[model samples]
Target: MFPRTLLLLLSLILFKTTHAQLHLDYYRNSCPDVESIVRSAVQEKFQQTFVTAPATLRLFFHDCLVRGCDASVLLASRNNRAEKDNPENLSLAGDGFDTVIKAKAAVDNVQECRNKVSCADILVMATRDVIALTGGPSYAVELGRLDGRVSTKASVRHQIPHPDFKLEKLEAMFATHGLTLVDLIALSGAHTIGFSHCSRFSKRLYNFKSKTRIDPTLNPAYARELRGMCPEEVDSRIAISMDQTTPQTFDNVYYKNLERGRGLFTSDQTLFTHKRSRDIVRLFAFNSTAFEIAFVDAITKLGRIGVKTGNQGEIRGDCTIVN
Candidate 1:
């Protein structure tokens, strides 16, 4: 048997080999203008609708969390058995899919770049562009992820965090993807610009626990405001901004809202209520620069999850259907 030290070294080498395949310039030779191409397409889409920003950003997170950023979330099975068909994913905005599809078309339009970039990479670039478009910090995105061939709805089960999740459940789910506590908190800040369906959080305002009809952590005024917007009998599809204060901008206001019991979801509020993460929440709430920096770093790491590189997957000509 190999010595313990040698075994440890070999494992480290293997880990690096797998992850090293992705980098800032992965398409430097194959698709030299890939980033700018995706950015332009995303910008055009953003101009058409503000939903492009939050939709695309949420798409990236859901795609990565479910299947390691493989763009499997983009695959559509005619039988309605694909990942996108999953109930948890059903709410993913059509705008997000459109953003990636538009960007993919733009990338392939350039003769030399045709089919040279992966749908996964286009999704990544578009996500970064949207964040920047919504007044969030912009950062370089590592590329080289390939589209996976498999996309079963069964794969999405238990992969997503529910709106009612507490800190423990949230941490456990994120940990499966190798995200740390700080990373989880930083990434959760993405809620700054998105909207959530009323059904997702109405329970917190109505029948939270046995002791109280409403969640005690929720600010009474905010609860009243939410009730006015989302009556118990209201349509489940009604949407509310995740960040009430600065709903259109991607910033540290998410943390601030949590501080004031204004978070729209139990999972969102848990970050500030849980002792382990509260200080980080306060730190971000008080410092936009620090929040921006942490957000960029955390999202960059998030983009690296379960990526298919080298010979593992394909660069599809069409994003929605496996080529």
Candidate 2:
């Protein structure tokens, strides 16, 4: 009887682990036009500023990586103790938060959908829409996430990958979230459209290893260009495109840039320099279709991280505050 009971328990656990309560049509009945509503809002924002694509994408990643995809990062605390207040998250663009807030407002404008959808789900749909708008794949997003009530600055520590992280550090961090090396490579492609503050990667161009002066991995010409754009005494807040080749397009050129030593971040170029991940980078660089497919699969899996369902969390009437 003990063995039988243990076996049954194990099977139940496995079932729960594999069957997360999220689906492409989760909001079909509660809010039939939820996806379109969020998509239209995102499109309007994207039209206003190209920053919408990368900022929203990065916000989704940061939110999911820290406390799952609960939208805790969206919460604002008057005492300035929320996750968004963390120094690591301070760089998150206001446009990202605005994108979700605007979409939430749009959803609530319709009587049937008012306060019916979770901010977490709105973020997921908005992320997909922005990606599609920026020439990335537009896959169906799995919904049904709920907004987390907790958003402490303490939770953001070491949760996000640093710009200078190497392949090993990156793999270990991603592994904790159930992401594979291929997933890491595929997701890094989001950098293809974003801009990074000079402080994030200036070390690569100015004081790599405190000895080489410049990171030897960077292409010489590219390094020179970066120096010109960000002089030694320039403001750290100066922005540089992550993918100089096609800053406005979300595509596999990020991998191609890695191959050419033009990657703006150490974490990015490491994907090509590290032997274990180099092959995957080469594959993505040469095959745009493979990159897109892997990205879609990876992001879908990412959306499943630490999700709340079945009364685990609440749907907030205001995305920036708990209901």
Candidate 3:
């Protein structure tokens, strides 16, 4: 009793799902395909400029990994963007600009990476490039994405996982995006190249108890930075990121920190205790070959959180704030 139009639509849906298979490079159908076109176009621009695209992509991942790729962190504050360098948080020695601008620089060194890819795809790919430029793995990114329009400093306030998360809260946050603690730490490893803002986790710097402090053996230089940022009078509610060492790189320095008992955040430290994930952490820290493979697996998994490709959802045009 179905109308011919309805029957045809149902048949097409059956055909598409049954005929398609998911690959890391491409998702099935209109949403994903549209996203892919943009990603590719932007990547080409970067290539033309002789700039590698992966490092910037890493930064986008850093921004999004914690709270779902909201561009609030990148939009650059009114005063800071015009005169100050924004990537300050990305490195203890950054060129003094927003990391996304660093990504844009790479693309500009080539052309408009954004024009080639969706704002979403360029956002992540450019950040990844940021990570690679440092020393981390240049992870292969999946394309075909849309930008979000509703990110809030508030959302950044509430959902962005702290460098100091314990296992349970860490797991819960990652789970929101279909990730796990293993994913959380691995993603947090993106921090290896970036510097911390004392405001992010001032408590750990000022009042960490040895029992609560995961890495009692932090680098002396790192300790100095922490002390300077927090000052003795600063309150605990301050926020900071964990990858003060190499914020722009995607290499195993983060794992290296984990190995040295120097990981600044509880989130990074949690990897050593989990029964299931500890090994992956050790694996990444010691074996670059293994870490690269594991990082790809984890990042691939991370990108898929809550997204509906292949009938899950549509690609948006922007990535800064989710509408």
Point to the candidate with the largest lDDT: 2
**Clashing residue pairs in candidate 2, if any?**
none
Candidate 1 ranges beyond 4 A from true positions: 1-18
Q: State each candidate's clash count.
A: 0, 0, 77
Tens-place lDDT per residue, model 3, 219-314, is: 556767767767867664454445555544457777777665566666666676656556666666766655555455567666554332334332
Candidate 1's residue-wise lDDT over 87-107, tens digit each? Answer: 999999999999999999999
Which lDDT values do the candidates have, in the order given? 0.88, 0.90, 0.50
Give the range of the ten consecutive residues with the poorest summed lDDT in model 1.
1-10
**Per-residue lDDT of candidate 2, residues 209-293 (tens digit):** 7576999999999999999999989999998999988999999999999999999999999998998888778888887877887
Q: Give TM per candidate.
A: 0.93, 0.93, 0.59
Which runs in model 2 stand beyond 4 Å of their true positions?
Answer: 1-19, 210-212
lDDT of 2: 0.90
- Model 1 TM-score, 2 decimals: 0.93
Error of 3 at 24 (Å): 6.8
